[model samples]
Target: MATLNRRRFLALSGLSAMGAWLGTASVLAAERDAAGLLPRNLWTSPRFASSPFTVGVASGDPTPDGAVLWTRLAPQPLEFGSGMPPRPLLVHWEVAADPQMRQVVQHGASLAHPELGHAVHVELAGLLPARPYWYRFSVADHHSAVGMTRTLPAADAPVDLLRFAVAGCQHYEEGHFTAWRHIAEEPLDFVFHYGDYIYEGASQPGVRSMNGRPFTNLRNHVGEQTYTLDDYRRRYAQYKTDPDLQAAHAAAPWFVTFDDHEVDNNWAGAQDQDGTPSEVFLLRRAQAFQAYYENMPLRRSALPRNGHMQLYRRARFGRLMDLHVLDTRQYRSRQVPIADRTQVESPARSIVGAGQEQWLFDGLADRAPRWHTIAHQVSLGNYAREKDGVIVSSDDQWSGYLDSRRRLLEHIQRTGQGNVVTACGDAHRHYASDLVQDNRDSGIISSEFLATSITSGADGQGEDEFARNTLRHSPHLRAVTDKRGYVLCEVTDKHWIGDMKILDQVMQPGGTLSRWRRYAVEHGRPGLQEA
Candidate 1:
């Protein structure tokens, strides 16, 4: 793969009329073809009869000397009661510094039991930090597809540069994953998926499924929705089979969290916005959380139990970066009704909950890094507006929890913390804003870079127009786009740059990508500027 040179990229784009620059779509297509050098027929065929491993391999939660590698034993995957045989099977895993797995670094055995859904999570330790590793799993004589992963840098190392991508909101029935196909080709250290990994309900009418296939429900969702353990597991299995998503997972390790759609849209705590009891809802939450943990390469410590999962955690990338991941949906207050948008500003309402708020403040105040990145679910900027004497508030974002947002901003400013950049994914549009101490105030404390959806909402209702209008109204906002794609960020000692990659189209196949905009934040300056 070729490295992206900012200077050359800018020069070529400036002369795009001369045909000196290739569009992102063509370049990405070429890269994808190159990466899949193996014959398509050979790659897709079943490698084993009874212990088939259909889903490709993946890894995450990387440490300096280790990382977790993952795979599922789909002996007869997707068929009813066919994912695994009734008997226990032994699975072998290996890690190496190279793709061919010649120089083995770690090897282990994990028993695939029917009780745990026949999935494997192998955590490997004692590897080098800031280095790439390759791994795969084997059942009997058949080997799973090879996967690539990497570890974070040491806590105090002075790193020169760090590269990563952030995206969320992939509704499987809405569109093809051409964006993921493109992102899989980028040379990135890791991928941060901010939430809404899969939609709980089956495909609604008017939503387009990938590869011209109908949106088939694999889980036969109970109550005509997804809530039970069987329902949740089936939904995950359906999503895990996507070729584009699988490719992206194989490309790099991922850090993930969930928003409401993982269970239901706009659900909070034990009561939804409608003020109804959530006893059944809580039971559903437990099953969904468990299924999520079973599929991802998360540590066992983050497992779900009795309808609750501990997802708020931190990751350090040498001395250059510290990532504070947030789980906004699990412990948040009830969603304010549409009629009570003004009432949401009350301090009683919480987004991260009171306890989690203190945890975040303590983490931010404890140590100073070149960049303090927050991996959060919803948009933090105030996106409310008024037109024709009528007020409109997004019931789904941090705007619905105004007091918590204010407290977070005040804490950062009061502590004099610099370079606090938030990487968000929930709203289906891309946004870059300077989060001021006060939106109307002249003083700015930090900034935010929001990425668009991976493949959600079938191009988002009027999102492009909304983004343009938002930029015009808010002077702090640098740029906005409704295109479907992800954000690739590169952080250096003195500056942090965001590349907004926009897809050509989401409702169709073979969509291409292009750098829609570029913005950079200088040291000690919270505002953004076009690069």
Candidate 2:
């Protein structure tokens, strides 16, 4: 085989990301060994006394040609700055056709910079699409766990089936991540963790009562609510050390975006729940955004700069489905009181900002895919909870931004768009519902499947008064469960099926996993039906 020249090599690998630190635009091609990794002499490698790949490996933002490979070089992840020296280190990575990595396909070297918390995001762009590939990262003597990732099918190609999972809300102090273990074992094409990946609060202090039963926190956070870049980095490092979460990331490529808790609970735009000043909060928001990009399997395109990250992008699975991931918290207006019907119905309100709202409106009407799906944070339905014996609406959900919700739904109806299914988090409880215009009996428009948390809210005791009240009053709601788990969706040309995978407990290891609810939507049909 002919050796790859500088232009061909640059086109195949993402070595340019490290150009600032490495002081070079191209690397001379070096002879490879049977293992597909480069020879030690050709690359500058740092020898870590202890393994720095403590957070494991992950891949995400897959295009037709390639995906982003992510890992943070952290040996002591719990301490400040991940206990790493402030310096740049060369890291080698490779991809292979076989799991054993004997059939090496492409390989290259990149630098992990301390400015980005020693994180490496290798963005490869020349590989076969619609097929599975194995990848890993290495330093001088340490190698990360092998992760499996696949590219989406070519845009014009037809796909027969697509399987993926939706999961999020993993508060470290809540409970164990047993659900992630099961997710790792599932045969999935990709995973969407919609938000609240890390709870910003400090350690939980004592026992609490739920349903008159005494329970204590199963774990604890390291510090107070994350505010600084180091604090956010430490929080992410602690969460990434979980074996179950690591396994899930290695299982398949993922699509990740943050909700409010990544910065502060119930935060929207520049305002926080505690009424912190906008300028003060933007500093924290920027820090949190940087830490989020550093830890997750995300591309540099989503990198944080000046407190902003472009996270609302689109991906696809051939012509079978269009994957539209939305960012709801970053650009939303201040949340209004649910009791204030007048404020909730205001036309100026928005949960997905104006730009993202327009993008969603335009894409939903596109005729390329048979199925159109939206994965985001927060619920998107008219749900109400009981307050003072009166059924009051929820301000944390779309019900709070009634006019905004109406505009999107009306667009879907007007454009004659169908097969619109939304997978969302932040509710903590799992909900399967058929969305309608203002809960009208004849206003069937789309289907919504809300994923429960991985460990947040601990092992909940079934439905509570709030959930019961919401379900009873919300005419479109079909099912609600407080179990800790995720949603598994399988789609084809003619049908879309979502399974509500549940767990009995998360306070202890080896929680039992089961499934009782399955929501189905037929081709050309919009609303969901119990299947």
Candidate 3:
């Protein structure tokens, strides 16, 4: 396998012709007008039809010579419940060493079935590893925008850098994905989506779309409103339609995990507190898990069976980075009561379950990479009461499971693990913290970076005060921002930098993004600091 820098890779691939081949801004505007997918016609014909390609194209699970490519086709647009004919379309994929693809490396075909809502995932193999690659998809006469992807380095290879993005909690009804658009413009090897990819439950009545229309439900509400395969699939399809999300997906490969929104808000392992029977919730979970698998570019082994999903996995980027993706939603105890939030601190209350805990510990113990990253959903750091009067434990967070969090942090501290940085989502706000093991005590420590929502919350206005107050109350917290955006990370052998990119407003289609803050973790420092 060979490695090349961005300039050489682009020069070799002929990406300079992207504007001409992919379509010019003017031409896309014409296409958008002809297609009518955007409101008020930002541009006619936009590059791809105004379809859900919004979640974009992404590749993940990169191996030495192969990677998994993903994209969901939205030919029917966003008119939910209008059962469009399930067309079995032939989708073509191509990977190139150069942007021009003059140096085509791999090419293949995948079936985009309407039954699966045209979501197509192709796992391409036999390519060079530790190298950069460009890819694109074509269905019928329509061609997807070009995307960037990379393969992991050889298991024992000495790696110099590993760049990636981390984000989650995108509520379509909350705001636009301008932040995603900005992220798409940056260079990234892959992305880690830490759950809340879509809010499976109904949108709150007062929520409004970018166009001021009341938020629409992707599915017609029914029953206790969950545990159905169709319901999950429809929700995913609806989310897949966002153009900004599509652009982000098209920009790089992604590693993902689910939090509460992927199923129901605050849903713990096999536990539904909404008066639903345990059996019914479990069945619904199975359906949701299966639907999630079908939509994601996941390997067959990770697929769900008998209503259970295995989300814990590992991905290595040469010797530069080792990402331990955790399944916090599965194999965990239920949320504790607000009053007894501190009382629920029991080791028996597992977030990743016993098996997953072992897996994570083992991965960390190996210490094979320059950087160790935990792509887990939700905050791992403590978020206790900010003031005496405020009620703090939102059982869904690590705050409720203090014992479990301590055990994991203690493991990292005891092992003397270096660069053990955690990437998380769920709080709907961007945060940077020095994950001290004994946050209440001074001797123990670790580091974590929590990303803001892609669109969830009211334009990034969810519980921001609580987060700010929590940060102020806890010295371990480095920074906090209640903004709608994502986190961009640039990892190298010597250091890892996390950039919080914030959008002005998500309620509109296109907004500006400004850097809120930046933090850095040195090669051997298990903590974060101002960059």
Q: Which candidate achieves the best TM-score against the true structure?
A: 2
Compared with the true structure, what per-residue lDDT tens digits does model 1 show for residues 415-458?
Answer: 78577888997878888888864434638788888998987755
lDDT of 3 by residue, 245-305 (tens): 7777767777888887778877888887685788878887877887787678675456566
Structural similarity to truth (TM-score) of each candidate: 0.85, 0.92, 0.81
Better of 1 and 2 by lDDT: 2
lDDT for every model? 0.74, 0.84, 0.70
Decide which is better by lDDT, 2 or 3: 2
In model 1, what lDDT does residue 489 have?
Answer: 93
Q: C-alpha displacement of 316 in model 3, angstroms?
A: 1.1
Write down the lDDT that model 2 would get.
Answer: 0.84
CA-RMSD of model 2: 5.5
Clash pairs of candidate 1?
Answer: 65-127
Clashing residue pairs in all predictions, respectively, total 1, 0, 35
